[model samples]
Target: MKFQLDQPQGGNSISRHDGQHVWVNGRQHGASLLVPWRGEVQDWALARFDDLSEAHFEQILALKPELVIFGSGAKLRFARPALYRALIAARIGLETMDLGAACRTYNVLASEGRSVLAALLIEAA
Candidate 1:
């Protein structure tokens, strides 16, 4: 499974998969995982953050994915209510999980043709 990145819309970007891992402007991004071209291209937004609460919500909003997965690095926690509410207002589903879990979930959802966005914080393993 490869991921191909379309030219960014401003600082934000949309990456489509060709086969393997996800790429941003031809550079591989470890923060994201891309599955093979299944059928319909699933839309996704990915952002890296040090603190999930401080992440820029506008980016996710711009993508307008059906589901939002918050990757809280190696540690997992509930997302702030404000963030959840914002997604709810946009009619997006929100899932908060560890980064690894989120990555796996993103790949599975993408393969299944479900729209998903991921905010991942990388931690030293």
Candidate 2:
């Protein structure tokens, strides 16, 4: 689905998401990636929920977002806390949802100028 809003001056906002792909600032991305409010969009190496590991969560630490919106592919699946212990230890909040919800939530928070990061996974068809 495509989203409409008064785009933030320079921050990143999700334009559309449809399970298999996500459009950020009008650009299409087909792989898992990390989208921050205002910064470089990083490629996340995960391809499936089952491949999630501590290293995955650890990689996000470098971005230092106040909150993380984790998109667990096409469905809402919770990850083991142990996998994201590093984030917890750092006091960074993490929220999990299906990809669509994550994209919508990220857009709202980003537009409000919140320090949010979206860790979205795009699973294979």
Give residue 57's error in model 1 in angstroms.
1.7
* TM-score against native, each model: 0.58, 0.94
Which 10-residue span in candidate 1 carries the lowest summed lDDT?
Answer: 34-43
List per-prediction Cα lDDT, in the order shown. Answer: 0.53, 0.94
**Per-residue C-alpha lDDT of model 2 across residues 1-125, encoded as one tens digit per residue:** 77755678889979898888999988999999999999888899999899999999999988999999999999999999999999999999999999999999998999999999999999989
RMSD of every prediction? 8.6, 3.0
Tens digits of lDDT, candidate 1, 3-110: 753332222232432223444334555443322222222223333333444235655666677887766656686767775566778787878887667656676676
Model 1 clash pairs are: 1-19, 1-20, 2-19, 2-20
Q: Residue 86 of model 2: what lDDT? A: 96
Stretches of candidate 2 above 4 Å error?
1-5
Give me the overall lDDT of model 1: 0.53
Candidate that would win on lDDT: 2
